[model samples]
Target: MNDVLFRTGGHAARITLNRPRALNSLTHDMVLRIDAKLTEWEHDPAVGTVVITGEGERGLCAGGDIRAIHDDARDGDGRASAAFWRDEYRLNARIAHYPKPYVAVMDGIVMGGGVGVSAHGSVRVVTERSAIAMPETGIGFVPDVGGTHLLARAPGELGTRLALTGARIGAADAILCGLADHYVPSAALGDFVADLAERPVREALARHVRQAPPGVLAGRREWIDSCFAADTVEDIVQRLLDHGGPEAREAAETLLTRSPTAVKVTLAAVRRARGLGALERVLDQEYRVSCACLGSPDLVEGIRAQVVDKDRAPRWSPATLGEVADADVERFFTPLGDRELGLAGDGPLTAPGTAGPGAGR
Candidate 1:
């Protein structure tokens, strides 16, 4: 079956992610097709708006097909996974910059690649059912698809906590973190979608949008800001552990469960992404980091423990965060030689030995 379905009527073109059992996890082909359809719709005078939704009540998307990535990493060369990320990241950039109104209906669980497609859109709609997150650290990978770009810009160090813990947030927190725009109740979603088929996105949103239920992040911001502000992952963990609050110490425990290398690399990527500024530049940086992850033992083991083996206990290489050296983390940022994603549209980043202007470091 087609993993994605497409149709157009009235002023809008719609795309639905169709793999319900797997929660609409994206495959490389799905990424390519979505990009092609967007390119086609961009030029069509009848398509004033573009809407994306998932087929199931479960969620919009879970993430990339990690089972496929696990197989590729364990048995095949890493090139296929890298190629998939290359195209997926490009599609994310297109969605962010797309000229027409791009409306993403984020209901139920959305994570990783789900956040990639929805959070970057011009108009992001969330529901009471929305449980949004990047959650890449849990799978021994850093956030890609402009996630670091969005995370780095969130208020204070809230992004830092979410990145390390791979925590899920509801609609209010998502809006507070700039990951979503308006909130509509889950019951209103059907009418909201029907309205999008005939009216402008703003008008459709106006009809159904309502205040989101309260989120927990705002109350925890004090501790989240203080604990996650440290420069290094170890320091961040230390701060969390030192903080007296039950939630703060709980956050520390959650960090300890993550892949040490992945956590360190994530902290580095998000910090560098903050400096990188532009979404394209940050995405270029993410491509390098993601490709480096394909080479890591943790990426395979994490997926094995979490997804394949269903063990929930990942034996991360190096075993502890203290063992992950600065040099080791830096390797993820190394220029990809001739294979660089170069999405900055200006110039490639300089060698690791030298950090140039707008280097996106």
Candidate 2:
């Protein structure tokens, strides 16, 4: 059976991630197929909106197939991992620029690569079951697939708190973070998506959208902003510890649990992405960081412990935050020359006649 299934009906085109047992984890082939499908749908006037969802109750996607990443990074040269990231990051950029209304049903356990495929879309819908995050730091990897772009743009340092702690936020917090657009109760999703196949996106959303339930981040922003605003990971940790709130202290302890190198590199990546502005540029930078991560000992070991061995104990090489020098973090940002993703739209626009986003809606 296909890992990703595509179909067109009425005013909508659909892409369903079909690996239910794996929480619909994304793969390189899935990425390529989705990209090709998007290209085809973009030219089809019959497709008024494009909708993406997963097949089962678990999630739209858990993440990329990191078991493969572990094997490639551990046993082979890093070229395989690099190619996967190249196509994957390009797909993320395309979603950002897609002229059609791209609707992502971010239903459950959306994390890592899951965020890439869903969050970049123009219309992101989260259900009560949605647990959206970019939890790469926990596995000795930094967030990629335009994750830094989305996180960097989040209000204040809320993004910093989420990135460093690898925290999962619900529908309310996801919308608060600008990671999602609307909230639809999980029970109503079937009808909501069914409506998409028959009506314009605006009409379908009007039928089912509701305000998100309350979330924690709005209340914790005072502490989160003050603590995460520090220049370095070391200072951020210290601020969280010094704040004296249980949540702040817990966030500090959470930082201590993640891979030191990964957290440090993540902090730098998010900050740099903030200044980088365009999503395409941030994605280009992310491609560099992701390829650099493939070379890190932590990437393989972290994957082995967290996913392979199921030990949940990663022995980060730098061990402590201080051991990761300024130079070490800087290496992640270094360019790959000809290998650069070049996703910055140097060429002509994809749809000159298209106004994009709200056009067909």
Candidate 3:
């Protein structure tokens, strides 16, 4: 079956993530197809906007197809996974700079790769059912797909807290964190999309916009800022532990559950991303970190325990924050000599005026 469906209606070109059974996890082919379509629509005068959503009630997208990636990393000499990320990151950059309004109906679980596609859109709409997160730390990977960029820019230390803990937030919190633009009830999403097909994109969205209830994150801002304000993951954990409250204890414990190396690397990535001026630069940095982790023992082991084995007990190398040396973390941020992520216009993955790989067939 087709993993994605695309059609044109009225002034809008619509795309649907069709892998409902898998929570619409993105694949290489799907990413290439979406990028090609977006590139086409970017120049088409008839296409005033683009709208994307998932096919099912479960999720817009859970993440990249990590299980497939795990297999690729094991058998394909990492070439397949590397190519997938390159194309996916390029697609993310395209969506961020698309000439026309890009609308994302982030109605359900939007995590990892899902965030890459939807949260970066110009018009991100979330519903009460939306459970947005960047949970890469739990799987021993730093947040990628420009996730560090979004998380780094979140209010105060909220981004740091979210990055470390892999916490899922509702629509209100998503909006507060700058991950979403508007909130509409899930029931009203269909009507909103219908309106988009007939009216101007902004007008349709404005008509459906409703005030989101205050998110739990807003109330915890003081705690988040105070606990996560430190420069290192170790210091953040110490602060949380020393604060001596249920929230603090829970936050610390959550951090403890993630791969120690991942926590440290994620902290460093987020801090670096704060000073970045462009999304492309942030993506470049993330790609570097991603390639570094691709062959690391922790990434493979973490995936095995949590995904392949389903044991829920990943024995992370450098099992504690103290064991993860500064040099170990720095290597993840270093430039990738020949394999650097090329972010120049059109990039190395797709050429201008030519169909992207997997575009037509």
Candidate 4:
């Protein structure tokens, strides 16, 4: 079957991620196809809105196909991985700025690449089954796909906590953290999409939205803000350790398990993303970091343990935050010289007028 299914009917354009058995993990070809379709439908007068979702009962998308990246890294060739990231990041930028309303039905697992596809849309929908996260740190890489842009904009230091821990959040928490916009039950999603095909997007969505449950992050915002507001990962860990609460201790332990380099880099990325003026700028920074990590051992090792071997025990280089030098962390943020991602455009996929969503957060 096609990895992705795209169709246009009535007043809506629809795209479904079709790889259900793999949780609809995005492939490089899939990203390019999505960009093409969005570009084609952007100015179609009959298409008032675009709707994206995944096939099957499992979820929307788990993430990018990490095994592909792992294999490329193992081969000591970074071309494929690098090309995938460059294109994926550009697709993300396109979605952020698309002039017509873009709707993402985040019905299930929305993490990593999935977040890139959904979270930036103008209308982001979630269901009771939604489990949203940017769990890249756990895989020995900082969150990309403009993850830092959304996480950085989250209320308080919740973004920092989420970035470092790679923790999963429910639908309400997804809304609270600004990663999602509406909460519609799983049962109502079909009817909502049907209405979207025949009626105005805002009206269709408004009619289906329901009250989300109390968010877990909302109640802990004060503590999350205090503990994660530190300047470095080391400082944040110390604060979490000293806080002497179960949540704080758990957060600290989770950080300990992730790549020390990734933890430090993620802290810096989220902090810097907060000051960025545009999503493209944030994506540019992420591309630099991603390319740097492609040459590092930790990323491959992390994927081996978590996905390949299922060991869940990765031996990260520079094993502790203290062992990671400031210069080592700085290397990930440096310019890519000739290989930088270039996303300038005046096409249908490009955002109209100002910088698209998540700009100036």
Please report the TM-score between candidate 1 and the true structure: 0.95
Question: How would you order the candidates by lDDT, starting with the best?
Answer: 2, 4, 1, 3
The list of candidate 3 runs beyond 4 A from truth reads 344-361
The stretch of ten residues in a row with the least summed lDDT in candidate 3 is: 352-361
Worst 10 residues of 4 by lDDT: 343-352
Candidate 1 Cα errors over 4 Å, as ranges: 346-361
lDDT of 1 at 196: 88
Best by TM-score: 2
Query: Superposing all C-alpha atoms, what RMSD in Å does each candidate have to the true structure?
Result: 5.5, 1.3, 4.5, 2.4
Q: Give one digit per residue, the lDDT tens place, for model 3 in 255-356.
A: 999999999999999999999857888999999999888877787777788889999999898888889999999999888877988684334433455432
Q: After superposition, how far is residue 181 of candidate 4 from its true place, in Å?
A: 0.6
TM-score of each: 0.95, 0.98, 0.94, 0.96
Ranking by TM-score: 2, 4, 1, 3
Query: Which residue pairs clash within candidate 2?
Result: none
lDDT per residue (tens digit) for residues 216-270 in model 4 = 8888887789999988888889999999989999999999999999999898899
- True-structure lDDT of candidate 4: 0.89
Model 1 error, position 185 (Å): 0.6
Instruction: Please report how far candidate 2 places residue 86 from its true position, in Å.
Output: 0.5
Predictions in order: lDDT: 0.89, 0.91, 0.88, 0.89
Error of 4 at 335 (Å): 0.5
